[model samples]
Target: MDDTPVRVLIVDDQTLMRQGLRKLLEIEPGVTVSGAAASGQEALALLATTTVDVALVDAKMPGMDGVALIRRLAAEHPSVACVILTTFDDDEYIFGGLAAGARGFLLKDTPPDELVTTLRRAAAGETVLGSPAAERVVARLRTDPHGTGLEALSAREREVGDLIAQGAHNREIARRLFITEGTVKNHVTALLRKLGMRDRTQLALFLAKHRDQR
Candidate 1:
């Protein structure tokens, strides 16, 4: 494993929260606080110049909320992994963050060590949800085990979905399936549309919930 520390950017509207997070992460051996921003615009500005490996964002900022920030980051800085760190555990915020491209959704009460671990995992290209967030998703999966249009997916699309459920990103999926990364992305897009899902996290959970059906 690489010993290089993950560079994290903190984006929270609260001064105390941003400062506290920076202090907490700075004490960790394998994590570094790259910068702290008070809002989404500041975060975008900082991201334009700073080399951030992961963005730890609050879900309920004043101007551009965490979900919108993640969406912008997904389009503007695709390499920077995003994680939502917020006090709100409502389904709207949790699902919104995940659907908007956050690699992780963690409650503000998450342990310091777990937050650091989540940042590392997100930077490494794995979608991670904190324990509370995971429980909510699991409940949702139990209720909606089969998504709307799984039967419409082609065989290759099903393979891609399975790979996603196995925690494989596009590059890894491409390698495993003997296809180009571009092709893997195409399949992922198709799967998302066919399943009425917003992002890879939802697609993965949907596939995992209905694995027996496949």
Candidate 2:
């Protein structure tokens, strides 16, 4: 808690799942699994008492599923970055998870090394969400006939979308906006979730079609 490694909380319905996460994350340097919980209620109780940098929350659990868990976490523990680990990749879950303010959405079969890396990114407060299933969702959004979801973007998000349309990378957008790259990255994530697009590519393309209106 004092000048120590990054503290993490693991939340999953299965005891074996928590144990596996503990063992895997223990190997990462400067990262500690501070606590493990069996349900969203337990996770909320633990968060109220302890400090954690990132939380690996299972997407499905009894009583409170991952979506609601993320919503409550965002409302109660706004600083905690949630990385949803789930077995399913349904678009409904992806959109629902991001809407709940999860920083990253990962699958259970993700490699141990990638899992650690994703956790590090989350601890640093960046947004990252993508999976093979999300690719189709992205494409559908890009090709949707009315594009109503993306039309609701805020002014700043619209500007970012314009630049993304012009093929600017995150660093370039940061430079242009005079903001830190981290902020730009966060904006990109927010835009994706708000617009229901899958990634930057889809976002860029969305702007390509809607620039005249902007």
Candidate 3:
């Protein structure tokens, strides 16, 4: 909480959303809007030339998308923290954003003061999950505290599981593992059977919870 305002870049497809966010953050005491972009590609270009502390990105965008942008930001601009500020709170988006290295996940309905505080905290290297996002994560952790079924997984299955937890689709997982997409699907099916999980979301959350503990 020094006087140096946290520099933030807003990335949203809607012009009004970008403008409204920019206007809102501009009035905050310890925060400043560095720039705004309409797409993920534009946001990455801006980050390449601009000095930004945090990028507030929308989860759904036309091209490149929020999760893809966040993955790139985490790899290329590790110093610039990313926060997903989208209206969608679906498990797909929530875990995908977190797995892509977002420092925070917040809904658009968040109060102005709370949103500002989250941006500041994210810039300072904290992970912030608002409301249902936090609740979902907590519930996952509580469901399988010890990860009892993980011991049955083979090495390749474990690798696939970890990648799934990181939000990698089957094609991406296959490419990374040098395996066929069918093989990836088989591994995913086995993981679900062994873990007794209903779907990929549960599998992702189960692995993510264990990873966080480690």
lDDT of each: 0.86, 0.80, 0.85
TM-score of every candidate:
0.68, 0.65, 0.70
TM-score of 3: 0.70
At residue 146, candidate 1 shows an lDDT of: 47
TM-score winner: 3
1-214, model 3: which lDDT tens digit per residue?
2788899999999999999999999988888899999999999899878999999999889867787788788889999999999988866566667766889999999999999999999999999999988986776567656634464568998899889989999999999999999999989866764554557898899889886532
Which 10 successive residues of model 2 have the least lDDT summed?
Answer: 144-153
RMSD of 3: 8.2
The best-first sequence of candidates by lDDT reads: 1, 3, 2
Poorly placed runs, candidate 2 (over 4 Å): 1-4, 133-137, 144-214
Candidate 1 structure quality by residue, lDDT tens digits, 67-155: 87887898899999999999888665776677677899998999988889899999999999988889877876776564244555689
Tens digits of per-residue lDDT for model 2 on 1-214? 4445778999999989999899988988878998999999999999988999998999889988777788788888899999889998865456667766888888899888778878878888887765654574576477654544554456787777788889999899989988888988878876765555655786788778877766
As for model 1, its CA RMSD to the true structure in angstroms is 12.0
User: Count of backbone clashes for each model?
Assistant: 0, 0, 0
Worst 10 residues of 1 by lDDT: 144-153
